[model samples]
Target: MATLHHSSFCPHSRFVRLIMAEMGMEPHLVEERPWERREEFLMMNPAGTTPVLVEEGGLAVPGASIIAEYLDETRGLGLSGLRLLPESPAARVEVRRLLDWFLQKFDQEVTGYLVTEKIHKRFMTSQHGGGPPDMNAIRAARSNVRYHLKYIGYLISRRNWLAGSQLTYADLAAAAHLSCVDYLGDVPWDEDEMARNWYARVKSRPSFRSLLTDRVAGMAPADHYADLDF
Candidate 1:
């Protein structure tokens, strides 16, 4: 069995968790608070990121993308239409490009702000005693979210998923970030019916059930978050 070092609410960590569930592999879950800067955690991945995977031979894999590939390669979890990468050069490039979009774009526009405000406190404590989140930054993030939804809406209206016709890593990665936003009702579900319809299918997956159960301190998930049909 593989061991994964991660926290419960991190979007990146959640990415790895979703991949594990989708691939049907059970990994030992070890929580790591990124701010703690522990030597042991540092040793696993000097980059200091969560979602580190330690293999049987003790090769530590960092980043959700790498870990997902490792699992598919080692565990033979490759489902015909579900393998994230494509064999064709063009399609494979597109898949990787979309993956980067979600990891970087969505991270900057959505997860970065929300995590720092609502989710980070529970996992990342301030180096100083305790500090309140920056309301101004939160406001900017909230505003940025609207554009992202419009973009996703356009994608859903045109393509079957966030990528092209396939449900690649792009979908899972986007879903990972959106799950956090959705938990807080930050997603404007009524913004676009196509996007809402797309989300309805994504959120109904067995891989999504655990995320629906996630809770944040002092904030209840949006009432409709766990409702599969809603």
Candidate 2:
């Protein structure tokens, strides 16, 4: 079995987790806080990031993009579950584009700011220079998320999934970030019914069960986090 080192609220980590579940591969999970800068963890990933996947044979895959591609290349055999990446060159490019959109653009504009202020700051010690959450940053993130929700609604209105007719890495990537924000009660789901309806379908999947049940040590998810209907 492989071991996945990840943080509970890291959107990139969550992306990899969702992909693994959707692929029907269950790797052992090792909860890690990259800010702690553990020596052994650093040896595995010099980037000091969550979600370094280490295989039983000692092969280590760092970064969400690398891991997703690695899995798709190695385990994506035959007609099993939906392939995270599409077979056609053009479709694959679109999936990667949307994957980057959420991982980089959405993270930069919304999820990253919110999680850093709300979750990461809470875990940092005073010695590590931790302080109160930045209200201004939180407010900015909140405002930005509405635009993202609208974007999600717009995409789903035209296509079955974010990238196209198939459920690809694009959908998983978007959901991963949205799930983290939703956990903080920051997502304005009611403001966009289409986005909410699409999310409701993703939430009901067996692959999403583990994430929906994830509980941080001192923080509880919003009341509707695990509610399939909501």
Candidate 3:
């Protein structure tokens, strides 16, 4: 079996986890603190990011995007209708576009700030820059989240999922990031009914079960974090 090095609140890590679950994979999960910058971990991924997948034969796949593509290439063909990536090149492009939107753009604008300030810092020591949460960054992320929720609402209003009618990696990527913010109670779900409904549908999936139960060590999630009907 493969082993995945991940962090509980990292959206990119969460994205890969959801992908693996949807693909019916059961890799061993190892929680990694990237800030700690362990020598062995760095050797696996010199960039020191989470969500590194180590195969049984000692192959290390680093980064969520790379890992997602690697898994799809390795296992997705067998899944047929259940494949998270589409068959058509154009369709695949759309999925990758949304993947970039959520994993990179959304992260830069939202989760990167919220998670770092609210979750990551709490786990780090002063030597690694841990301290009281940065309210300014948190406030900016909070404000930015509303816009993202509105965008999600806009996208879902016209289609069954973020990229299209199919449930692709796009949906998983978006849901993963939103789930992290939702855990922090930073998402303004009530402000976008369409987005909230879409999230509810995604949240209810069996693949989402583990994420719904994830907890931060010293901090509990938002009241509705694990509520399926919320």
State every prediction's TM-score relative to the real structure: 0.92, 0.96, 0.98
Give one digit per residue, the lDDT tens place, for model 3 in 49-70.
9989999999999999999899
Question: For model 3, what is the C-alpha lDDT against the true structure?
Answer: 0.93
Q: Who wins the lDDT comparison?
A: 3
Model 3: how far residue 27 lies from native, Å: 0.5
- Worst 10-residue lDDT window, candidate 3: 78-87
Task: In model 2, state the lDDT of residue 227.
Answer: 93
lDDT of 2 by residue, 36-133 (tens): 89999999999998889999999999999899899989987643657779899999899998899999999998988889888888889977647899
Per-residue lDDT tens digits of candidate 1, residues 84-157? 66567788787778778888888987788888787676545456223677788788888888888888888888
Model 3 misplaced stretches (Cα beyond 4 Å): none
Write the number of the candidate with greater lDDT, choosing between 2 and 3: 3
Residue 191 alpha-carbon offset, candidate 2, angstroms: 1.4
Q: Distance (Å) between predicted and true CA of 5, model 3?
A: 0.4
lDDT of 1 at 98: 76
Two-way TM-score contest, 2 vs 3, winner: 3
- Alpha carbon deviation, residue 147, candidate 1 (Å): 1.0
Q: Would you list the C-alpha lDDT of every candidate in the order shown?
A: 0.80, 0.90, 0.93
lDDT value, residue 148 of candidate 2: 87
Q: Candidate 1 at residue 14, lDDT?
A: 87
